[model samples]
Target: MADSSCGPRPLPPDDLALLSGLQPHDVRKVAESKIQAYRAMIEDINGYIIQLSTIQNTTVPLHASLPPEILMHVFRHILPTGPSDLRLTHVCKLWRDLIFRTPEFWVDMLAISAVTAHLDHNTDSPLSFPSFVVRSSPLPFELDLHRGALDFLRTIPSHVSRIHSLSLHLPLGSDYAAYLTALFNLDMPLLETMRCSTYATAWPIGLTDSTTHRVPDGQKFPRLRKLAFCGPGLPTRAFAFPSLRELKFDDGMFSEPLGPLMDFLESCAQLEVLEMNIQSPARQFRTERDAVSLPHLKIFSLLLDAPEGLWAYDFLEQVIVPATAQMNITWLAGSDHPLRYLIPTSPLSLSVEAIQVIHTLTIRFNYDRTVRDDSKWILSVNGFVPSHSQPYLKLTIHCPCWTLEEDVRPSDALSDLSGLFTCAPSLQKVKLRLDHGITVTPDHWFVILNSFPSLSSLTVRIGSCRSLLTVLRRNPTRWPALRRLSISCRNGSGVHECLLSAIERRAREGSRLEYIAFSGSPRRRLSEHRMRRLEGLVDEVTTVNEVEFCGMH
Candidate 1:
């Protein structure tokens, strides 16, 4: 009989006949032969695997030719804790092994929330927080958590000391006191940088919330060098950062009493860079304390939006910096208050002796009465030391104008412009750009021009060139020290005639220009005919292309 294990299917006619004629011994022998063939096939497969393994071990791939250290160094250029790093581990078996062994590749541990996934496009399955911490071993690593920051910190209490940098991004409308308390309670001895930000509408813990959850006393980050707080938060109080050198606060308004803010600044005595953008409240009650002294501060930037009044000036009176420090102050105030109020005729916060000898001054005045909004007027002043590539001081003031007057009085414009240059007595180079919306008579321009008696070089832009030419034609002896003149215009149609007339008139008066250059758009370039005319009146004449002229500005 056929084996019952073969199931109910009937065998082929010839196979059935052969099986009937064969004895039991013949069937057993056939089965033994089939078993031997299967063994031989398994052996062949095993040998093939061994041969392939031997080849892989003996032959080196192109990437494997380099030393493991060099390859790891190249991988460092790729992003640390993202899909890019995950791809490196899957390139080949050799690379996979090397990436797993190298601890530097796993030094940045990140946990991202769905809302902030755009900040870190990491969706790899292998990046568990604990796995990263263990894989990174004893080396210092950075921790970036976009959400669930407080809970994550709870699970890794022991690993806080190894954190090199920590960044936390909190959701909008969430209470920030818990986050701050969690941060203050921890001890981060090796931490070098810490950044905490939120999307809250206002500071989470304001003056009203000061009574709740006070920052623990005697807490400090000893090695912290950089601290940044964005969005809004409670006042910094009762914390010490002896080595902190840089601090930044953006989009925050200090609560009514400025005492807490002052106390926080007093702790960071060695700060080198301090930047803040806060809104100042109206009622200016002078904080009854000595100015916070930041002698080591090299870059100080303060931006304020005070609609009720010019509280920025009053606030700045409490802070003192070095005379050589660079300052950039921007204030947005009501139209009734002039820039002269914010930047007084006498130096308010800046040292008088340091600003008295500035060499280069750039004045950019833009105003449009037609648009009755807060951005209708902006006055920008930049001062530079002759040898320095960076400006030592920059002051910009914005005001809202409700008036629709097409023309303003000449004296009104002169008063505002003259009061600005009182501190720049030693200025030798001036770049003046005025918007077309502002209208002024030639006499006003002449008065403004004569204020810089020591100015030897002048650059005029746009419609301001017409007023300058009129001033030069009206009074050839206006700016006696002016020798070099550069004029840039949007259109050069009737500008050539004005330039020729002014230069010829100035030459006839014996105060000949030493050099003159005219630049405009490609389609509006001065004709060669007019270029020759200007060349005769001045010692040297040049026409600058549009691309080159924009850089000069």
Candidate 2:
């Protein structure tokens, strides 16, 4: 408070006198120490001056002031995963430095297409493949090599040890056996996933060697866990995969017998998810080999697109899925078996370990053009646990014809459904949706409704509601437990007469429906008189658009 001015204080007189009495050497030492102190003071002052100038003349960015660790985290959060992340280097010097130092941003940033484009001088990429491989450093990385990237494929063997995932998108007839053999010969200690797909094309032409990928006799993938292989056969023989947890095989042109493939699967007992989609599966299994048991399997999907006899069922009989797994099988319907016999004559025909009781059933008949623009009907049967959106058991039958008069008759389909009802005696709900030009007779509806003794809800959406309403009108006590009923007509035909008669008959028999929902196109909405009549019959009546009704149900 005495003198608030900015300046150095003078040394006390006694201290100055002590310095004046020093000898020559002492004086020199004291001078050097004082010089060092003054120089440090001057340097601090210069720093202050610079800081003040910066505050006054320029703005300091907030990011520049942030610590490097925080900046790295921010950069990772804002950056994309692939080559797009490299654009951050152009933002500023701090960002560039942070991105360069952080290895995670460069891990998944390498794509063969971009790298080869740079190699071929096709584009001026910011970072070359070699640069990324170096900048990513010792951390594990994912690699993607598409068809015709043999130049990069040649470089894979050098870096295969550190790869976490490798995906090779070979086209129909790729000839990368030498490169693939070279890559597989090396041990991938860090590899967790490997996918070799032909992009849904034909299989490869030749094997790596006469037998398998000359993979050093006993070479194995020590840490490999997930594998998705699609081709005529696996690239390697019974090479051990002790850590494999997920496996998927999708080969549309698999022509080999089941013996070799089954022998390969017998080694992977720890698999949790297995999916096999082969257009034509092997019809016979080696009699000496027992069913392959997957104790830890959580999801199993087998799609046999062959339009032959029960190959899907035969494949299921060869795999022993645990009771806890969810299963889906899509089999093409053959011309010999009726629609009812397309599935196993009984659920016992499937592996006992794979069967789960059905509580809810959904059958949908819709037209599809998947088979070369032909008119086909896809009958998808989905069974689910209560309150579950994902089906536990899904069976799909693909038929070449779409109408009742065609390859499949509605009565035969109902008879097949009745057989399914025998399997699920406790079935509580059923939903049937038929597209246009497919109509069932009232007798078929009568048989199907009487089969579900415990069905509490029934929803029907067809071309016409005449058969269903007539079935209900004839007998009100058929489905004694059906409390909810929803009906929609595709043609939007006037259903008021038949619908009112059905509801009146049910009411007269003391079988009152708790909820009734009727839907059709907007052009065929129920008139005011019909709406009042329906509301008076049912406790809760809803008149919705056909689209909204389907969505809500």
Residues 309-337, model 2: lDDT tens digits: 45665665677777567888776643334
Tens-place lDDT per residue, model 1, 1-553, is 7788978866467555555656799977765776697699999999998678655843676554777778777765555544454676666666766776666666642432332233322333345565565566677877777677767766767777788788887544444555566666788777888787766445433433334534344344678888787765423653336677888877455444555556667776888998877764542433677878888988988777665334555555667666567878776654345435554336544433335656888877777667764366776778887778788778776652322343334235434555556666778888877665455566667767776778789886655367768888878876778889887776555667888888888889988999887776567677788778778888998888645755674
Give the C-alpha lDDT of model 2: 0.68
True-vs-predicted CA distance for residue 425, candidate 2, Å: 3.0
How displaced is residue 428 in candidate 2, in Å? 1.2
Q: How many pairs of residues collide in each model?
A: 0, 0
Q: Work out how many backbone clashes candidate 2 has.
A: 0
lDDT of 1: 0.66
Return the lDDT, model 2, position 112. 39
Give the TM-scores of the predictions, in the order they appear: 0.66, 0.65
Q: lDDT score, residue 117, model 1?
A: 37
